[model samples]
Target chain A: MAELELSGVSKVYGAFNALRDVSLQIADGEFAVFVGPSGCGKSTLLRLIAGLDPVSGGRIAIGGNDMTARQAGQRPVAMVFQNYALYPHMSVFENIAFPLQMERRTKDDIKREVSRAAEIVQLSTRLQDRPAKLSGGQRQRVAIARAIVRKPGIFLMDEPLSNLDAALRMEMRAELTQLHRRLGSTMVYVTHDQLEAMTMADRIVVLNGGRVEQVGAPMELYHNPANLFVAGFIGSPPMNFAAARVDAVEGHAARLTVEGLGSFAVSYDGKEVSAGDAVTIGIRPEAMLPGAGEAGHLSFRMTPETVERLGLHTIVHAPVGAKTFTALFNGDPRMARGSALDVSVPLAQLHLFDRNGAGRSIRDIQ
Target chain B: MTFRSGAADAPAFNQNLGAYLFLAPALLILFLSLLLPAAATIGMSFTDISFLRPTNFVGLDNYLRLLSDGRFQQAVFNTSYYTLGVTLPTMVLGLLAAVALNRRFPFRVAFRTIFYLPVLTSLIAAAVVWVYIYEPYSGPMNGLLVSLGLPPQPWLQSPNLAMTALIIMAVWRDFGTAMIIYLAGLQDIPEEIYEAARLDGAGKFAILRRITVPMLSSVTFYLMIILIVQSFQVFGAIYVMTGGGPLGSTETIVFQMYQTAFGYTEFGYAAAMSTVLFFVILLFSIVGTKIMRKGEA
Candidate 1:
C-alpha cells in the first residue's frame, strides 16, 4: 500500500497534447477512478502512473519515492489491461506464478503465493487450464490474479471489464470492490462508464479534453458539480439545461426568465450577475413533476413524445416549445403521444451555470 | 404458399453437386500430373524399361541390384547427410530471421525483399554464381580467407568439402520460403498475448521461449517437411556445381537416379531408387505431422 502522487504530469505526442499539467494525489489504500469520455486522456493518465508510458513533463512518486524514470517492471505497480492479455501458451498457474518466478522466489514460495492469489479470485480449480479454455469472465479473473501475485504497491486497471458482457461486468465490478477491501492496496482505475466510476470509486476524478474537471466523492459530484461538464455527465438520465435571462436582482434574490417557462425568483447573493445577464438553468429528471398545481410552479405545456416503461420507473420525453426534455416518474403514467401536459421545475433543485459553463455554487450563489 | 417439408434434403443434394463441380479442375489436374505418373512409376519399378525397346519384366531384380550397388549406397548416405545438415539449420535460421523482421523497423520492406530474392532465383543460376565465388585461387571467399592469414583451401575440389559447399548453396537458396511461412505464423499471434506476457513479468527471452516457440510449432513442421523433401531431390545444384565429383562425395539419391536413367541408360535401377526416395520423404512427412499433432494436443 502506497500513496501515489502526480505533480504537473503532461504527455505530448509530437505537437498534439494528450495530457497537460494534470496533477492528482491518491492516498494509501484508496480506490480512485478516472472517468471520462473517449479521447479524454483518462487511460493516458493511468498508463503514466503505471509506467507503461513516459511522461513528457513533471514527476511521479510512489510510496514517497520519485520513480519518474523507472521502467514498468521497476515501478511497484501492476496493470490489468482491458483485453485481459493472458499468455496464450501458459496454463493459469504459470501465468500467475510468472511474477514470482521473475523475482526468483523458491519453488514452495511461488506455489503457495500463486495458489493463494488464485484462491482469492476463485480460480483454484482452473490452475491447470490454459487461457483459451476459459470463458471471458474467467479470463478476466486470471488477469486479475496475475496482477495480485506480484504484491505491488499499487494496482492499475485500464477498463478491465469493458470486454465482458453486461451481467459479467456487474459481477466483476462487485468482485473488484471486495478485492480492494480485502487487499487494502492503493488502486487507480480508468473507465468511460460513469456508473462504474460512481459505484466502485472512493474518489472519482472526472476528466474532459485532457483536463481534470473535478475530483470528489461520487455523491459529492452528483450533488455539487464544479462545472457544466460534470453536471451533465454524472447521472443516469442526463441533467437538462435551458437558456434563461436574469429579470430582477435584489438582496440574495434574483428573478430569472426562462425561455419557455414564466419568470421565477432564485437566490443568488454570491453570484456577480446583473439583471439582464444570460445564464443556464439545469434540472434533474426526477426533480421535475408532471403537474401545474405547486407553490414554485415553473410550469410549461409540452406534448409527450415517447414513454419508456422500465418496470420500476418510466421516463417520458416531451417537447416544450422547440426543445426536448425527459422526466422520470416512479410508476407508469398513462400519458399518450401528442397530448399536452404541464411540468414543474423545483427552484431549489435547479442548477445555475455561468456563460463559461462553470457551476455557481448553490450556497455561494445565495 | 405451402411450406416444403423436404427443403433440407434438397440442399444436401445441391451441396454435393456444388462440391463436385468446385473440385473438378483440381482433381483433373492431379490425375493428369501426379496420379498417372505415380501409377506409371509403380509399374516401371518392376520392369526393365529402356527408351527404345519393349519393356521387359524384371520382377525384384532392380531391388536386388540396388542392395549390392556401392554407388547407390553412397548416394543414400550422402542424401541423408545433406537432409539432416540443411533442414535443421535452415528451419532455425529462417525462424530467427522472421522474428527479427516481424517488428516495425526502418526500411523493413527493403529487408524483406532482399531476404526473399534468393528464393526467386533459379537454382542453376544460383549454383553457377556460387561456383565462381568458391573458386580456390582467385575467388572472393578464398581471397578474404587468405587476407585473414588462413590457408586458401579448395572448396568444391576436395572430397570432404564438396558436400558442405552444396549444402551451403541449397540452404541459402531455399531458406526464404521458410522465412516467409514463419513470418505469416508470427503475424497470426495476437498482440494481446504479448501484452499479457509483459504484465506477467516475463522478459524478452522468456516470452520468446514460452510463447513464440510453442505458437510457431506448426510452421516449423511445415517448413521441415518441404526442406526434407527438397533435400532428397537435390539434383540441379549438384549437376551445375560438382556433378557429384571429387570421389562422388556430393552424389545424392536424385543425382544417382539421373545418372543411372539418363547417363548409363539403366532405367530399372533408377526407377527403384526413385521409389525408395519417395518412401523416405513420405515417412518423414507422416512423422512430422504426428509430432506436430502431439504438440498441439
Candidate 2:
C-alpha cells in the first residue's frame, strides 16, 4: 500500500479546462472519494491518478516516487471502470488472472491469486463462466476481483457502482467499505453520487467546475460545508436558501431581516458586517421542527403544497415567497395541503453565506 | 372482450398484409434471379443438352466424368490455392490498416478513402489495370524489381508465377473491402476496454493480440465467409488478365465453367460444375455461420 500525491495537476483539452490546478493527498490505507456533478472533473482526476491520461501541468507522486512520465502500464495502479470493462470473451478466471498474466506469472501462481481474489469477492463458484453470462452485480465483482488480483499499491475506481441498480449499489457500497477494511490499500474513487461518497469515503473531496470545493470527513462536511455548493450538495432534499439583509451588527452578532421570515439575531465569529449588507441564510429541511413559538428560535410560516409520507418521516414541501421550503418532521405528521404551518429551526443551526456563495457562518468559522 | 379482440384482429391482419406487400418485390426478384437459375442448372446437369447435339437424359454421367477429369481437378486445386492465399493475407493486411487508421491522425479520413477506392472500382476495370501493372517488359512491377537489383521476371507469363500474380492482384483489390468492414467493427469496441487493459499492465502488442483480435472474431468470421464465397467464383480477374493461360495454371472453377459452356458449347458439363460449386459455397457458408454463432455464445 502507498499514498498518492498530486500537486497542481491540470488537464486542458484545446480551450476547455477539464481539471484546474487540482492538488490533494490520500494517506496510505485511506478510502478517499472524489465526489461531484457530471463534468466536475472528478473522473478526469481519477484517470490522471491511474496514469491513463497525462497532466497538462504539475507532477504526480505515488509512494513518494515521482510518476509523472510513466505510462499507465508502468504505474503501480489498477483501475475499475464504470462499466466494469471485463473482456467479454474471457471467463471470470481469465479476467481475474489478466494482470498476473500480463506480468508473465507462472500458471500455478496465476491460478492461486485469481482464486484468492474470486474468493474475496465470492465469485469462486462462477470462475469459468463468461462475463456476458453473469449478472450486473457479479460482473462488478469480477472487476473488483481483477483489480485485487494485481495487488497494486493503489486502486482507482471510476464511478464503478453507477451502472448497478439502486439496491445493488447499496449492497456494493457496503461491500466496498468492507473490502477497503480488509485490503487496507489506498483507494481513490470518483462518483457523482453524494450518498455513495458520504457512506463509503474516509474523506470526501467535493469538486465543482473543475476546482476543489472542500475536502473533509462526511459528518464534518455535513455539519459545516465550506461554501454554498457544498452546503446544498452534501445533504438530501438539500438545504433551504433565503435572501436576507443585515439590519445591524453588534460584536459577532448580526440582526438580519430575512425575507418572508422576519428579523432574527444570529451569532458569528467573523468580522462585523456593516448594516445593509446582503447575505443568504440557509436551513436544512430535516432541521425544521414542528410547531413554532420556540423562544430564541428562527420561525417561519409556510403553506404546504405537497406532503410526502415516507414511513418514518413526513416531508412537507411548501412555498415561501417564490421559493420551495421543505420541512421534514419525525414520524408522520398531520400535514394538509395549502395549509400554513409554523416551522421553527434552532437558531444555532442556521448557515449564513456572503453574496459570493462563500460560507460566513459561526459553525464554519469554528 | 370479444368486441375488442375482433376490432384488434382486423387491424393486425391488415398490418401483416401491408408488411408482406412491402416484402413481395424483393422476394420475387430473388426467386427470378437466383432460385430459377439454380433449379435450371440442376435440371440441365441431368441432361446432355448442348448446341452440338440433341438433348438426352444423362443422369450422373457428367458427375462420373468430373470424378475422373484431370483438368477439372487441376482447376479445383488452383482455386483453393488462390482462395487461401488471397483470404489470409487480405484479412491480415486489412486488420493492420484498420488498426493503424483507427487512431486520430492528420488526414486520417483521406487515407481511409484512399485505401477504400479499390473496393469501389469496377472489377473489370481493376482487372485491366492490374494486368497493365503486371506487364512483363515495361510494367512498374518489373521496373521496380530492376531498380532494386532483382532479376526482372515475367509476372503473368510463367506458369508457376501466374497464379501467384493473380492472387496478389485479387488481394490488392479486395483487402480494401475487408479494411472497411474491420474499421466498422473497430468502432463498436468501447474505449474503456483499452484503458482497463493499460491499467492492467498490458502493452500495445498484448492488447492487440489478446484483446483486439479476439473481440473482432465475429467480424473476422463474417469477412472470411464473404471472401471465401467471392474467391470461389474468381472468374473476371483471371479472364481479363490470364484468360486461363500459362498452361491452365491460373484457371479456376468458374473460369473453366465459362470456357466449357461458352468456349466449347458444353452447357451440360458446365451446369454440373456450377451445381457442384454452389453446393461447396453453401457448405462453407453454413459451417462459417455455425462457428460464428458458437463464438458469440
Candidate 3:
C-alpha cells in the first residue's frame, strides 16, 4: 500500500476551473472519500489522480514517487468505473484475468489467480458466464474482481455503487468497506451522497466550488464544520442559518437577537463586536426539539408547511418569516400541516457565522 | 381468406373495410413489383420463354446443360473471387477510416465529408473516373509510379491484373458506405469500456483488438453482407472499365448473364443463370443472417 499526495492540483477546461489548487493526502490503507454536490469537482479530482485526465497544474505523488506525469496504465492504480465497465464479450474468468493477461502471465498462473479473485467475490459459480448474463451486483463483483486481481497500490472507485438500487447500494457499500479492510488498500471513493460519505469514509474531503472546504473525520466534520457551506452540506436536515444582530456585549458574553427568533447569550472570544453587527446563526434540525425553554437557549416560532412521517422519524418543514427549513424529531404522527409550533435550540449546540460565511462555534470562543 | 365480423371483439365491417382501403395501395404495389416478377422468374426458369420462338416447357434441360457449362462456371469463379476481394478490403479500409475520424480534431467534419463523397457519387460517373485513373500512360497512378522510379504498367488492360484492379476500385468506391455504418456503430460503444481496458494495462493495439473490434462485430458482419451482395451483382465497373477484359478474366455472373440475354439472345440459358445466381445470393444472405443472430445470442 502507498500514500497518495496531490499538491496544488488543478484542472481547467477552457475558461472554467473544474478544480483549483486543491491538495489532499490520503494515507496508506485509508478509506478517504471526496464528497461534494454535483459539479463540485470531486470526480475531476479522482480522474486526475487516476490519470484518466491530465492536471493543468501541480504534482501528484504516489508512495512518494513522482507519478504526476505517469500514464494510467503505468501507475500502480486500478479503477472501478461507476458503470462497472466489465467487458461485455468476455466471460467472468477472462474479465478478471484481463490485466494478468496483459502482463502476459503463464496460463496456469492466470487460471489460479483468476479463480482466487473470483472466489473472493463469491463469483466462483458464475465464472463461465459473460457479463451480459450477470445481474448488476454480480457484474460489479466482476469489475471488483478485475481490479483486485492486479493488486494495485490504490483503488479508485468513482460512485461504483450508484447504479444499483437503494438496498443493493447499501449492501455494496458495506461490502466495499469490508473489502478495503481485508485488502488494506488505499481507496479514494467519490460520491455526491453525503450519507455514503459519512458511513464509509475514514476521512472525508468536502469540496465546494473546486476548493477544499474541510478535511476531517466524519464526526469531526459533523460536530464542527469549518464554514457555512460545510455546515449546510454535511448533514441531513442541514443546520439552519438565520440573520441576527449583536444586541449587547458584556465581558465575555454577547447577546445576539435574531429577527423572529429570541435572543441567545453566546460566548464571546476576544473579538471586536459592537451592537448592530450582522451575523448569521446556525442551529441543526435535531437540536431544535419541540419544547418550552428559557435562557442559554435560542427560540424559534415556525409554521409547519409540510410534515413527513417516515416511521422512525418525523420531518417538519417550517418557515421562520422568510427562511424555510426543516426539523427532525421522533416519529410523531400527530404532527399536522399548517400547525404553529415553538421549538427551542440549545445555546451550546448553536453555530454562528459572520457575513463572509466563515463559521464560529462556542467551543472555540469559550 | 375469410373475413368474419363475428369473432370476439372483432372490428365491425366498416372499420375492417376502411383498414383494407388504407393498406390496399401499398399491397398492390408490392404484389405488382415484387411478387409477380419473382413468381414469373420461377415459372420461366422451367420453360423456354424466348421471344424469338414458341415457348416450350423444358423441365430439366437447362439445369442439365448448366452442369457442364464452362463459361458459366468461370463466371461463378470470377464473381466469388471479386466478392471476397471486395468485401474484406472494403471493411478493413472502412473500419480504419471510421476509427481515425471518431475523435475530435480540427477539420474532422470536413474529412468525414470527403470520405463519404464517393458513396454519394453516381456509379457510372465514379467508374468512368476510375477508368481514367487506371489509364495506361496518361493516368496519375502510373505517372506517380514512373516518377517513383518504377515502370508504368497497364492497370485495367492486363488480363491478370484487370480483376484485381476492379476490386481495388470497388473497395475505394464503396468503403465510404462501410465507413458511415461503422461510424454509427463506433458511437454506440461506451467510452468507459476503453478506459477500463486501458486501466487493465491494454495498450493502444490491444484496446483496438480487444475492445473496439469485438464491439463492432455486428457492424462488420452487416457491412460484409452488404459488400458481398453488391459485389456479386458487379456489372457497372466491369462494363465501363474492363468489358469482361482481354481474356474474359473480369467477367462476373451478372455481366455474363447480361451478355447472354441481350447480346446473344440466349434467353432460356440466361434465365437459368439468373435463377442460379438468385439462389446463391439467397444462400449467402440466410447464412450471414443466421451467423449474425447467433453472435447476438
Q: How do the predictions measure up, each by TM-score?
A: 0.93, 0.98, 0.95
Per-residue CA lDDT of candidate 3, range A147-167, in tens? 999999999999898899999
> Against the unseen true structure, what C-alpha lDDT does each candidate score?
0.86, 0.91, 0.88
lDDT of 2 by residue, A1-366 (tens): 999999999999899999999889899999999999999999988888888889999899999999999999898998999999999989999999999999999999999999899999999999999999999999999999999998989999999999999999999999999999999999999999999999999999999999999999999999898778999999887899998899999987899997688889998876636789888888999989989858868887888899999989999988877688888889988879987788999888888888744654433533
lDDT by residue (tens digit), candidate 3, B1-297: 555655666658755776798799999999999889877877777887778889999997887888898988899999999999999989999999999999999999999999999888988999999889989989988998999999987888898889998998888889889999999999999999988888888999999998899989988988888889899999998999899977899999999989988898777778888888889889889989998998898
Per-prediction tally of clashes: 0, 0, 0
The TM-score of candidate 2 is 0.98
Across the candidates, what are chain A's individual TM-scores? 0.96, 0.98, 0.95
Segments in model 3 whose C-alpha atoms lie over 4 Å from true places: A268-273, A357-366, B1-23
lDDT of 1 by residue, B1-297 (tens): 233344755656566666778799999999999989878877788999978688899999999998999989999999999999899888887888899999999998898889899999987888889999899988887898899999987999999999988888777877778789999999999876776566556688977888899889878887888898888888899999999998999999999999989998878778888998888888988998898887677
Kindly report the interface RMSD of candidate 3, rounded to 1 decimal: 0.6
Worst window of 10 by summed lDDT in candidate 1 chain A: A357-366
Per-prediction DockQ: 0.51, 0.87, 0.82
In candidate 1, stretches whose alpha carbon ends up further than 4 angstroms from where it belongs are A269-272, A357-366, B1-11, B15-19, B64-69, B290-297
Clashing residue pairs for model 3 = none
Model 2 chain A lowest lDDT segment of ten: A357-366
Best by DockQ: 2
List the pairs of residues colliding in candidate 1.
Answer: none
Docking class of 2: high
True lDDT of residue B247, candidate 2: 96
